[model samples]
Target: MTRQSISITAPNDHWLKAQVENEEYASKSEVVNDLIRKARAQQDEIEWIRAKLIKAEQSGFTDESPAEILTAFKEEARRNGDL
Candidate 1:
């Protein structure tokens, strides 16, 4: 693996060091990597939502009312094991 050095604010540096001190992470690199992984996952989710929104727009309007849309959303969420 390649290593890179970067500068960060004092507060941010303190937080990273605290992770190690608290034994939540073995090293600052681990904390940074975990944060990066979380950020990447969030970005992936954002992109997915964007794509779905665009597709929904292209699909045109729906006749479903707000309550009906909520019901369908709950059902879909349950089916997907997200609820």
Candidate 2:
């Protein structure tokens, strides 16, 4: 694995230390990596939503009701592991 030498604020450092003390993570590197993974996943989800919005805009009006649209959106999110 690659080694990093980044610095953080006192509060962030304290939070990382607390995570280690609580045994939530094995080390600061692990915590940072997990956070990065989560952020990347969220970014991917955002991109998916953005693409859907663009396509919807291009497709014009839909006949579906708002409730139906919301339900379909929630179902899709669940299927994508975002819910």
Candidate 3:
């Protein structure tokens, strides 16, 4: 991977240092990498929720039961060899 020097604000730099020291991250790079990964994951989750909302709107679907959602997720996991 290509490494580039990017400037960060003082507050963010301090936060990164503290995260590295307190969060058991191996280094500042690891802390930054974790932050990036988490942010991307959260973004993907938001996109998925948005898509679900759009589909629900199109179908005029009502709210689903929690148990149904869990069962569906378990079934999907099994189908994907996650179980």
Q: Give the best candidate by TM-score.
A: 2
Worst 10 residues of 3 by lDDT: 65-74
Of the two candidates 1 and 2, the one with more favorable lDDT, higher being better, is 2
Regions of model 3 farther than 4 Å from truth: 63-83
| lDDT by residue for model 3 (11-32), tens | 9999888887796787888887
Candidate 1 lDDT over 1-83, as tens digits, reads: 78999999999999999999999999999999999998998677657656655555556776555456556656886799755
Total clashing pairs in model 2: 0
Q: List runs of model 2 lying over 4 Å from the truth.
A: 63-83
Sort every candidate by lDDT, greatest first. Answer: 2, 1, 3
Q: Number of clashing pairs, model 3?
A: 0
Give model 3's TM-score versus the native structure: 0.66
TM-scores for the candidates? 0.73, 0.74, 0.66
lDDT accuracy of residue 22 in candidate 2: 97
- Residue 24, candidate 1: Cα error in Å is 0.7
RMSD of each: 5.1, 4.1, 7.2
Per-residue CA lDDT of candidate 2, range 54-77, in tens? 566557777665456556877988
